[model samples]
Target chain A: MKTRIDQCLERLRKTRRKAFIAYITAGDPGMAETVDSVVQLAGAGADIVELGVPFSDPLADGRVNQDAATRALAAGATWGRLLKCIEQIRRKSPIPLILYSYLNPLISRGFEKTARQATAAGADGFLIVDLPAEEMEPYSRILGRVGLNNICLVTPTSPSARIRKIAGLASGFVYCVSREGVTGMQKQLASSALGLIRRTRRWTRLPIALGFGISTPEQARAAAREADVVVVGSAIVNRFAAAPKTAAGRKAAAQWTARLVRAVKEV
Target chain B: MPRKRIDTEPDAHGHFGPYGGMFVPETLMAPLQDLEREFRAARRDPSFRRDVEYYLREYVGRPTPLYFAERMTRELGGPRIYLKREDLCHTGAHKINNCIGQCLLARRMGKKRVIAETGAGQHGVATATCAALFGMQCVVYMGKVDMERQALNVFRMRSLGAEVVPVTAGQQTLKEAISEAMRDWVTNVRTTHYVLGTAYGAHPYPVMVRTFQSVIGREARRQILKQEGRLPSALVACVGGGSNAIGLFYPFLQDRGVEMIGVEAGGLGIRSGKHAARFADGRVGVLQGTRTWVLQDSEGQIRLTHSVSAGLDYAAVGPEHALLRDLKRADYSHVTDREAVDAFYTLARWEGILGALESVHAVAWLMKNARRWGKKDLILVNLSGRGDKDVQQVSAWSAKHGGPKA
Candidate 1:
């Protein structure tokens, strides 16, 4: 009787290893590379892949992620195209996919329709970077019915009571926003994420995935040692953003994703 | 319609919604947080409010008069028009209304410098006036194009002892000036207060600014009741960051019969795909601060907008205005660049007083809709600022009318 998200979490727990959460911006530079990167992450040992859907004003993001989103948006990334890329990746890969976005896109796309389309495209869950639990009922209702989990973000600043409330609504796993700023490749993970993990433990038994500043293999190793899942986004998106928009560029980016995924998955 | 308790994110500190939050590099976050904490305490102190109000009334010119435009009303042969005369304030516009309040807050927070972004240069002049009054270091970031268009105001700010930093990045316009001001704020968060010209941006700001500017609508409502015995049938104003429109609309928002109309600059035309009509063409998104409607592409890049008036050409509309539109409390519309220019000239000829090009968009709608209203019906427009700064553009407009053959 386990939900798809609960099953995903159980799978991660039984492995008892750090679940590699490979993060890449959806349609950075181009859609073709985005599809290739997702597949490569799955093939190379990423337990779960977080596909960042770019927004114009990512208030929560740091500078690096903001630049990546601006580049992707400038190159013609759209929701329809991003969904199409997810559909293409699902055709051949069974990687647990989570679409990460801000509130505006979901509201604009009509919450019910977007949830249905996301489920149809094989997306397992969603993490709306800005929509907190207090304002989540409208969106959570539609997502709940479609068997797609709504991932909640618990920041270092969130009170223990707020953490429990957020965890009560979350299904897949609780995404611990490891630090204050937006998602970016950082040299060091704040020790604060450990404290947040310990605090959230009081709220629910859901697995906690640490994100928002994890960059290198060493940082990933540290985060993995503490939490059930280690999320890496800006570093992978940087590779895709820097690569040229061509067949060769996508191949190179995929190779890059494979290398990062390998580091996080080591037993 | 259940009202959920509004919550604030810890990382946001003092920012409102998504629009008003701290986004400085790692080094400046602590100082920004300190400034915000101090501002919070100072804001609650009654003595601080009394001191600021004393200065606002005696110095910055609070409670500007409400004038009924009988001549224009008779000529239009329909609705009577009234103007909340914000242009008569000390700095010649509503811009100074918030500047005085921020200068006081900056002094209490112990900040010694003031920086601002200017498009029409009205805000720069207003900020410069406060800096001179407070003897603080004032640096105004103005786009090169605006600096050229409003050269006299540039000279005016310098005369007031403020340095004008001409910005030439991105589009060479107001949008670029804002980007540069943000960069400046990031570098100097400890000693600088970005006197945002409108009611937008992170959390406390939208609320703080609206509170400061609310005096306009407050005074207008009382004056209208005393002079005309009831509120007007419609309220009209031009919206850039929407401060003036908000100033005129806030007190009347609950009045079921009062209609609020915000006129956006439609550049050439909305259908021509070039205008500053965020509500007309933009999707709901977050920008600068607060969740609002913005002119952005699918990937969330803020797009460059065009308008004949420098002050009205912003890619994002204010967050409160977005909420009002969503609730159907106000009607948002557009006026073409050509129509605005014609209205600007007509107003000068019809009335002895000239108006800023930014406010002419609203005047254009008034001219178009005047015939539809009955003789006794009334409309109140926020006559935001004077047109003296627009001589160069207006001279060229006049030359085209009579001076030379093209």
Candidate 2:
């Protein structure tokens, strides 16, 4: 049986429409709000939902996502709680969910056990920000055994050889970083991103998802034109963090996500 | 039965047993691989070795005296104590040894810029000094709290033509500073070499730093043999990331007669949850690009660590130390903040040798265990740095907590 992520991307390819992946820190504001936001994001046309597991030292994240993680961690987010939130979301919706995390938490739990538990909890895959392609062999084996995807990342600095290696290991999609820095919303997409997408296409048949620094609808539209999917994180996370408690804030977040989804789908 | 030899370790993948692997982001993988290639090539080149040796001999002042602490030995009247005076190095600490070597590597690699992260500012100052000497651009990331506490060293770093960037994230400490440095390296990997300050981090780093710092052990070994006609009974050094301790311990690992002790910082006490004793309180986990013993909560979030000495205020130890502890080759212990302070005063008063607060942890351990050794036994300690930069902080701490009675 195909995984939910693979099926979602395959279906999107057939429709000639790009996938819109939305990222938010789990347990931000609170767990209940996290569940509500994921459902709202899916309702707003997010083909895949990326739930960030909050870590104290999020080196790859910019100020916006970092603050979101800090808030979630402060609100008592744990690995167990994140899984529970996933279970809650699974009950309500069949959205393809990816657990985005740093490597320590998974290493602490033992990779095989974490992968098994996450698979059982209905998570489709994982995106470990710090696990380099070179060190992903054991993790890939564990994830493969559990029939889950281990999403691999490609960067602007990634050489062609490295890109091919990562592409070979990637299961669901290749995350192409739009810029060289951490995750954040930028006013303009990086000029080098187009070249990266073109280079990555030569190596993998899997869908390419461009993320990092993609914020505006125009940027999302442009990214959708070049890649199979576009991931918008910091902008959506910034909305919920600005006013975590109020209904109006969540409505604004959902509205912005829908706008991004609409722009990507139009491409 | 003979003990196993400790020379052939870390293997090819940088694993000291189950610990130590390159646990960095994909962005850093290419750079780390490039660094490893350059480092391996440089190690085999005689010219590179010559350049490092020249800098060590002239610029950084190597072969620092290994002195017999006659007064302390007489006072203790149990074990004869000697001091390896890394405090006499040009930058006032042993951090210069690794910095000079890395700076030389950067120059040889044709990199124009070097970046580093520092905790107590010793590594920052050393990197800045080397950069000035080599005419390379240097940038240092330091925690805001550390910058305030080690303001003198901050000024020293800036005066040496280094840009000091204060990191204000996650309790504003060494771990945060390192994260910031890693970010900078990722963004500027094309023209920069990260001068990681300790014997930690990715594969080539721990090995490279240890190779550069093993000069301390080599010198101490020759000096002790020349003076006492034999190896010392014990070798001790404070283990903050384990560079100094590893430097002193690496050469003597094969000597079954020498007992190596690594002293970690016990802020309040181990049970108090306010300490940097990774082996005692930390579990095996990956952080800052290597799998080592790290202080973390149940959910695997890195914990905020505490130590009177900023240099030792880190959550993780070097991976080699973890392996050593697990193999039972070296014993690990910790001294409380109060005990370290008392040792600082004791060394200053009795021997007229002021040491960094980080190094005093080793001295504190010796003082506590003095009665266990015979009068004929000899102990060697790595006095890792001078206390000039610490006098202000130490005085303020003393005023608030009342001076140690010792």
Candidate 3:
């Protein structure tokens, strides 16, 4: 089944421009702010919005994202609450929303039940950061039954065989991690990322979204040229973090994201 | 259907009957698979066997005594007890056995850098020692709190020229240290080997670490039969990540009559909501690459754990131990921090042996249950480490909690 996520990627493919995806913690600052941010970011030109399900131990995250998760978890974010936030965002925006998480949160409750609730609450799908392809067979079946997409990640360190296997089962889009290491802003992207993207390209017809350490618009522009989509996470999460929680603060955060979103689109 | 043997666990995918598997990022999938393949080859490689044997016998000092603890036995007035002195190993603990085994494998894989995660610092010191011996660069991740709790071992690791990266995430203990180490491994997997310290984590690690640590049980089994003309009726060891305990228990798993017990730190007692006792009401969840019994909230978020002994204060049990518990092959019990402190002094005064606070949980349990046994019963305890590294903490604890009464 083609979720809205598949349709959005299909739409982007028709238009020769790159897809710019923005990532933010689901309940950061507050769920209301998160709901508003999704609408605001979507209006500013995010092709898709990824909402991180704040977990206590974020193994794939760097300091910026980790701190953001801690703050969101402290502000009372749970799988159920994050799903409700998604429902709220769905009211105002049709931006394809994906849940970014570690396996514990989804599997911690019950896998099928929690996933059903996520899809029922209007989520397109979720990307469990720590779930390997070896462990995803059952999960893939579950996600498929619910009519939701299971986004797959391709790492720079992923071998050729593993990349093919991961790409084979992937739905919606294939996420290509820009380098080795956790998520954060980095000074330079690894050269291996290009090779990884090229290698992954041979196996899947799905759109490839490049992420990890993509902060600056210049870096976003460079990344956008290589893959079908560009993902900017920690840097975007950081922008709202430094601002106060007032209405003015929220608008300023949107304005800042809009500028970066425009730069990636221009590529 | 034939009853499955305990040793043939995790099958090909590393699942110990729906428990251990490689639950990691894609970046780590290939590295873990490579490690599993190399480990299988190294097991049959005669050169690998020779190097491990040579180092265990000469460098790490193997065949440590299985001593008859006459005074401790008499004090108990019940079981005639014996101690497997893993404390006598070169690094003052049983951790070196696995480190030597893994570091040698790292060299065989042509990886010149190694990374590890430590709590109570024993594994960190052991890894650093091996890195120095093998001429490899070493980096260890430790929780900020653990560095203060196990300061002596931290100093020992630095002295051996390993960089100790302080992890400040979450509760800042063993769990966070492991997460940080995993992140480091994912980033540098091409050049580094993550020497997971215990019989936990992914498929190959649980199986691999248990194999290396099985030396403790092997020696104890051989020594006990020769000394007493029979196998001991029971085996007891401390359970943190369940390495030393599994080390002692694995060799005896086939001996159906020999009872096995694993003691855990009760911390202020399980009722207080401040302990590391997973089996009390454990939830099966994934953490640090393994699916095992974890201490987590209803939402599956890992919870902060506490134990007076830093090493035992972890959120999850080893997957093999989880399977053993499920199979009812072993019994797990807990001892409070106060009892562990009392047991430390009692054992030292009676037997002149000061086990690590982590290992002394076994002694603590034995002391509590001393009246239950008789002289006809034989019990062998794996004293996993010496308490020299714990002296300062012990002194401060005694000063605050009051000195042990005679």
Candidate 4:
């Protein structure tokens, strides 16, 4: 089966507009809301949905995303529960799902087991938040063997020479961190990401997705104009915090996710 | 597999057994690739070691003396105590021992700048010293809280032409400072070297740091043989990221007669969960780059750690210690906040040596356990840093506790 990363990119290029990639932390409040949010993202025009695996110390994340992860983890989010959410999301949503996590959880789960499980759970790829490209051999091999795309990250700080190296190794799409800090709602994407995206284009035909600090629809729309996929994460997770503690709260969160997807997909 | 070691290889993906591996985010891949290649080449070059060794001895004052703590040992009423006097080294700590070595490598690599994270501010002071010595631009990131507590050191860094950036995020502690430093390294890998404070982080770092710090053990081993004609019965030091302990323990690790013990800060109390006792609570995991004992939740999120000493307030131990623990090569324990405070006073009054709270934990351990060993039994503790900087904090804390009036 063609991985969701591949399909999403293919559809995105044909559409002329950008791929709407929405992000939500797993088990934010509870697992049901998380799963519902994923499906809602798909229904609301998100070409792909990134599911953040909560970790205690998200060194790469900004304040907003970090707080979201803490909230999710405190609510009893576990690897098993996250996997179950992915499985449930796959039952309804055909949009590609990427498991965004730090290297520690995968190490504990055993990379091979995580790869196989992620693939089986209908995860098209993994965006290892901490597994930089130089150390990609073991993870990429496992991901390739399991038919899962091992997504790589390229940052605005990445030099031209390194950009070529990252684009070559990247599967799915390259996650271009628009800023030096972790994922959060930024006032704007870094001006350097555009140059990075252009440099990355010289190396690979693969889609380049802009993330980290892309929160507002205008920012997403601006970022979308420059890249194949515009990725938003902390914004979706933040919405759940404001929702009520009930079934309607979860649906409301799902609706919020859908709205984000629609906003990003707007031409 | 019974897991023969405390650390594993493939770098969590599968590289060195415990002490070597890479654990960074995907965004850092390209830079790390460049670093790994350069490091592999640097390690193989004989001149690299020669230059590092020369600077370590001449610049940072290597072969730091191991002085027998005659007064404190007699008062403690048991084993003879010796101090690996890193406090007497340039800049007043063992931190410069590694900084000098790393700075030389950075120069050789043609790097133009140095960046470092400071907890107690010792390492930042050390890094700034080296950067100034090398004529390189230096930036030091320290938690805002630490900058306040260690204002003198902050001023010292600025005097050495280093920019001290105060990190205000999160708990405003060492962990956040490290996070900010790593981000800076990733962003400026082309021209900057991150002078990591401890023997932790990704592959090569744990190994490189230990290698640089090995002089502590080498000198102590030689001094003991020349002075007392035999090895000590016990070796002790505080464990923040376990570098100082590793530095002192490396040469003695294979010697069965020498007992190696690491003391972690049992801040206030272990049960309070506000201590930097990684061995007591941390499990084997990867953070930054290497597999080590880390105090993290089930989801592998790094937790906020606490300690009276900024240097000891780390959430992970060096990978070598993790391996040593698994192999049963060392005994790791903790001393309570009250006990450490008591030891601090004892050192000042009995020995006239003011000790860092991080180092006080080791003193506390020796004081608490001196009676258990025979009179002839010798114990050596790595006094990793001096306490001159902590005088104010200690005085204030003592006043609050109703001790000798501040």
Candidate 5:
């Protein structure tokens, strides 16, 4: 059976439109609101919804995502609660859901067990930020057995040879880090992103998604020009963080995500 | 599977039994691989060894005296205690030994910049000192809380021309500083070398750091033989990231007659959930880059750790220490913060030595357990650093807790 991620990208390919992926930490405001946010993002034209599993040490993340994680943890989001949250979202929406997390949480649950449990909870794939391609083969194989895609990351600093190797192993799509720094919103997208996407095209036929520092609608449209998917994480999460426990904050987050998705779709 | 001997460590992939694997991001893989290769080649080069020796002897003041603490030994009324005076090193800590070695490697690798993370600022000062000596650009990431607690060392690092970046992430402690340092290294891997502070992290780092710090044990082995015509009955050292303890324990691992013990920080007490005792409270998990013992919650989030000494305030211990603990080659224990403070004052009055609070953990262990051993037994403790940097904080703590006076 084709994974939800595979079907989503294939459908987007036929329309000749870039995919709009939205990211939100699973327990940022609260677990119940997390379920609402994923369904709202899908309704707002998000092709794929990424739910960040809060980790204490998010080395590759900047202040926005870091604060979201801190809030999520403060709200008592455990691994089991996060899985249950995904199940709740699965019942409400058909959007492709990916578990975005650092390596420790998944490793603690055992890779095979996490893959099976996540598949059962309606997660289509995983994008572990700190699991390098060198150590990804066993995990990829384990997830593949359960028909789950193991998304891989390619950075601006990645050499061509390394990029080719990562592309070969990547199942769903390649996550292209648009800049040198950690995940955060920037006023403008890095100019080097286009060249990186072009170089990555030479390696794999899989779709490429550009993320990290893509904040504004103008930046989203610019990123959509060179990639198959545009991911807006910090921009949407920042809206929720601004006013954590209010309906107004959730409404702002939905509106902001819709605006970014519209910008990507417009291109 | 039977436990392997101590010599055949960290197979090609850098696993010490089930611990010690590269868990860094993709951007750091190439740099770590490059460092591993360079370290293997440099280990065999006589010129590299000669240069490290020269710096250790002349610049950092090595071959530190192994003086017998006559008064403390008499007070303890059992084991004769000897202090390995790493406190006499140029930067007042054993951290300089590893920094000098890493700086030499960084120079050899043609890297123009070095970055590191420090908890108590001793390692930061050491790295900055070596960077200044080698004429390289240096940046040290320290936690904001630690910077406030160790203001003198912060001033020393800045005075040596190193940029000190205060990390305010995740409780603003050593673990957060390390994460920030790793982020910096990933961003600038081509032109920078991360001079890791302890005998932790991924493959070559644990091995490379252990090799550089082996000088402590080598000298201690020779000195004990020269002074008393035999090796000491036991060796003890504080285990903050296990660098200094491993340095003194590695050479004596083969001697079945010599007992080795590593003391961890017991902040308030282990039951208080406010301590840095990894073996006592931590389980097997990954942190930084290596899979070692870490204090983590049931959901696998790294736990908040506490210790009076900033240097010992970390959630994980080195992978080698984990292996040693499993193999029963060395025993591990913890000393409470109050006991360590008392030992700090005792060393000051008895030997005119104001020991770093981190090192006082080891001294505290010796003071408590020495009476159990025979009167003829001899014990050696690694005095990791001087207490001048910790004086202000200790005095403030003393004023509140009625500890030692200034």
Candidate 6:
């Protein structure tokens, strides 16, 4: 059975259109408005919306995304409550959803419970940053029971043989990390980004999504040339991090982020 | 319980009975693999072994004497105790032994830049000193709060030509500094080698650090055999991340009758929920990188742990220690903040040795427990660091926790 993530990536590939994967903390400015922001991002043309379930120690993220997560958690984000937010978003939008997280939060809540709850909440998939495929078995087995894909991330530093192994283990689509580093905005895309995408292409027929250090629209459009999906994480989160806590303010932030998402969809 | 396999435990992937593995991002996987390959090759390389020995002797100073604490033994009136004087090492701690070896490995790997995360600044100072001697660029990440407390070591690290970055993330201590240093390594993996402070973290690190730190146990074994004519009844050391404890215990693991005890920080008390006692308060969870017993809240967030000693204030123990604890091969215990402080002064008064508060946890354990043993019952405590950097901390700790009296 194809999950929502698989469906979205397949649909995008069939349409000959690149997908824009906009990222944001599940409840950045306010928890009440997470459903609203995700809805607004979908309306703006995001093919897939990846929600970050805030963690206390987000070592894989740079300063901007880390602060965004801190703000989200301060506003009352939890594994249980964030799943509730996902259910709320599922009510208002059909946009494919992916929850970005670390291993601690899920392991703390018990993987089977979290995976079952996420599936019930209509969360499409997950990309646990710190959980390398080597330790994915126990969690993957639990996730597989609920029909969800645990996204595999391939970095520029990944050797060719491991790249093939990772791609073989991948389910929905492969996430190609454009550069070596935590998630953040960079002035330019790394020169090695294109090479990593080319290497990943040889191993899978699945759509390839590029992330990490891709903040600007120009970088996103350039990434879209060879990549099947372009992910904008810290870039979008940086927008709403300072937005006013009102619904209208968050809506405006979502619209501003949508413009970045929309520009890539035209690619 | 399984018999001690020593070096054979970690098994190819660095897992010690499900306690350790590479749990980092995909970006770090290749670098960790490269590090593991280079580390394994370096172990077999004669020049690499020669370089490490030369640095240990001429650069860091090795074969530190294992002295008999006659006064403390007399005071206890029952057991015989020996102090493996790691405090006398250059940079004032056993931390330098691993730093010198890792810095040399970094150079051999063709990496020109080295980075490390420090808690109480002991590791930071040692890393800075090695980087200076090796002429490699060094950056040390220290928590903002630790910088304020261990300000003396901060100055020492800076004076030795290393940039000490202040990490303000989460609890702003050792673990956060590690997270930030990981970020730096992820960004610059091509040219940077993260000189992890202790025997923890992902694959190769636990193996790499323990191998580097095993010198303490190696030296203690030879010294004790020559001085006492046999192995001590037990090997003891403070287990923050268990580097020093593992260092002193690894060489003696094969001795069937030689017991090993790792002392953790009891802080106020284990009941107070303000301690760094992972075995007492923690459950199986993943933190920073490795899978181990972690001091985490009910929601799985790594808890902010407290201890009088800054160095022993971390929330996790080494993965190998976790395996040993489960096997009952080594015993784990804790001493309260008050008890450790008193032991700090107790050692200073009796043996005229101002031991680091972290080291005194083991001494405090021996003081309270060793009295039950007879005069021939030997206990060797790893006094891992000198207390010069901690004098200011202990003085302030005295004013608040009451006088440091036995």
lDDT tens digits, residues B1-406, model 6? 8964654368677899979998899999989999999999999999999999998998777889899999999998977899999999999999999999899999998999999999989999999999999899999999999999999999999999999999997888888999999999999999999999899999989989999999999999999899889888888899999999999988888887899999999999999999999999999989878999999887787788998888999999999999988877899999998889899999999999999999999999999898667889888999999999988989988887787533
lDDT of 4 by residue, B1-406 (tens): 4433333223423244544467776555555555656766777889987887788778777778888899988888898999989898899999998898888878888998999999999999999999999899999999999998888899999999999999877678788888888878765666788889788887667767787788899999999999999999999999988889988998887677888999987886767888889888778777766667888876566777888788888888877777777778888999987788788888888888888888989999999889988889999999988998888878778878766533
User: Comparing candidate 2 with candidate 5, which one achieves the higher DockQ?
Assistant: 2
Per-residue lDDT of A210 in model 6: 87
For candidate 1, give the docking quality class from DockQ: incorrect
> B1-406, model 2: which lDDT tens digit per residue?
8756775378776778888878887888877888888999999999999999998998888889999999999898888899999999998999999999999999988999999999999999999999999999999999999999999999999999999999988889899999999888888888999999999998889988998899999999999999999999999999999999999999988988899999999999998999999989989888988998999997789998999999999999999988888877799999999999999999999999889999999999999998889988989999999888888888888888897643
True contacts kept of 3: 0.87
Please provide, for model 4 over A105-206, each residue's C-alpha lDDT reduced to its tens digit, 9 standing for 90 to 100: 877757898778888888888888777666677778888899998788877667777778878778888878886655677686789878878888888888
Please state the Cα-based DockQ of model 5 relative to the true two-chain complex.
0.62
Judged by lDDT against the true structure, how good is candidate 1? Answer: 0.77
| lDDT tens per residue, model 2, A93-188 | 999999899999887878888888999999999999988876789888888899888899998888999999999998999999887878887789
RMSD of every prediction: 6.2, 1.6, 1.5, 4.9, 2.3, 1.6
* Candidate 5 per-residue lDDT over residues A54-120, each given as its tens digit: 9999888888898899989999998899889989988999899999999888888687888899999
Model 1's DockQ score: 0.09
What's chain A's TM-score in each predicted model? 0.92, 0.98, 0.97, 0.93, 0.97, 0.96
- Model 1 C-alpha lDDT per residue in residues B84-154, reported as the tens digit of each score: 78888887888888888888888887888999989999999999999999889999999898899889999
Task: Supply the DockQ value of model 2.
Answer: 0.71
Model 1: chain B TM-score vs. truth?
A: 0.90
> lDDT (0-100) at residue A70 of candidate 1?
71
Better of 2 and 4 by lDDT: 2
Q: Kindly report the root-mean-square deviation of model 2 from the true structure over all alpha carbons.
A: 1.6
Off by over 4 Å in 4: A1-18, A26-40, A70-94, A106-124, A133-149, A154-228, A233-267, B1-16, B36-59, B401-406
RMSD of 3: 1.5
Docking class of 4: acceptable
| Candidate 6 backbone collisions, by pair | none
Candidate 3 backbone collisions, by pair: B10-B15, B78-B374
Proportion of the native interface contacts kept in model 5: 0.54
| Per-candidate count of clashing residue pairs (backbone under 3 Å) | 14, 0, 2, 18, 0, 0
List ranges where model 5 is wrong by over 4 Å: A243-248, B1-4, B403-406
TM-score of each: 0.78, 0.97, 0.98, 0.83, 0.95, 0.98
Model 1 misplaced regions, further than 4 Å: A1-9, A244-267, B1-45, B67-81, B99-208, B224-234, B253-259, B278-305, B314-332, B349-354, B372-379, B388-406
